[model samples]
Target: MLASFRERFSMLAAVLALGVLVGSPDARAETLVIAGDPWCPVNCEADSQRPGIFVELARDIFGEAGIQVEYRVVNWARALHDARKGRIDAVIGAARNDAPDFLFTVTPVSHSRMCFFTRSNSRWRFTAVSDLGGQRLGAVKDYSYGSVLDAYLLSHAEDPTRVQLAHGDRAFALNVDKLLNQRIDVVMANAWVMENWLREQGLGGQLRNVGCRTPDLPIYLAFSPALASSPAHVELFEAGLRRYRADGRLQRLLQRYGVSEP
Candidate 1:
């Protein structure tokens, strides 16, 4: 009986190894729920025909590893909160420091160039965090402008009068309106997001960048600790990313959405 049991265990182990090697779906499907901040051209609401570049890229990468990826466009703040609380599996189109505790994949999924926007006639440039003191600034609620800007927001918690945090689908238009009316000195947003929205709104010719641009930060796929993923899940996803890039899938996907090489 002992020898029979040993034989059965050995056979089971061999079968399991073969299943993994052959890309079998013997393992349960792990649905990696990723949240995006509805940034146009890169990541936007899922309803958009071009549901952002990261959407397709992430889906294919994880699919290769037999892991399912479900994307949802939600308020950026809610996305972060959900990920932090382990209610979601991951967040895409995220900066390196956006969620420091999450496990970041090896390669960056994309890049975001952030800057300040103002009326063409205004001179409210964001040279430093201190420069924002006592100035009217319009920013999206729950968004981060790197460490410097984030720190400024934290330190000035007592004086919330300077920043107007908009929370609506028309947030971009609201910021533009405030700036054009001199209600706000400057508005902050991702450069790509600003350009896309401006073009969509036909206000591209009116607004100008203050050029206090954050160097294009590499965006990544970060997994939450509460994610029901194997310890090797991150590694597998990274490998898939590498393979996708090597075979030129990433570039093709970008081109498919009319995005140019950065």
Candidate 2:
């Protein structure tokens, strides 16, 4: 009877030890979820076989820092929404000051300019923001074009309906169609992306760049406020990024995706 009781106690103690080990915090590894729009060629993609340049650079940076990264390919709006909600730890390529809810790293991995696309044969020229006042302009829905353009549009809202905001998976296609059909006067897009899209669709020669919204738009790796607030992890990732940038590895990766150095 005594031997049986001792055996039972020993078994119970072993089970308790195992339970404690399983429940320990150290047993679980830390992972970061990064989200981006695959439509933005430099940032994200749907093809598992070919990752975007920014995605590849991010993976290398975070991997070197001993952090595991899970890439989530989402729509532009959803990706921004997730970043704001802390559902995503980071965003690969985001414009500076794009969102107030996120924190950006000090160094940018890439840069591009925002430009307007118009019909190839159109005589209309765009030199300033006021040039778009009387013309129908197609812009991405829910996107902030900064205070300057926003204020200008607000002042001229009644005149020719200054801006025509559009949305959906077919926004770009719709914009292009509008230009082709002479429905919308112009379409706004990032230069590199628009050029690539146009080339892919065999419409490159049919479109012409009217003007650029800004001289240069710097793209950075943005992190949710919640994630950035965690000093240890944020610092780890930032350090990794800095190392890549310093060593020119990030530039090489961007070049692989046809991103030009500025």
Put down candidate 2 lDDT per residue, 101-178, tens digits, no spaces. 677666666676778888888888778887875688877654555557657645655454566665665566677788
Q: lDDT tens string, model 1, 144-182? A: 668878776666644557777776655766877888898
Best by lDDT: 1
In model 2, what lDDT does residue 191 have?
A: 78
Model 1 TM-score on a 0 to 1 scale: 0.79
Clashes of 2: 0
Residue 98 CA error for candidate 1 (Å)?
2.1
Clashes of each: 0, 0
Q: After superposition, how far is residue 120 of candidate 1 from its true place, in Å?
A: 2.3
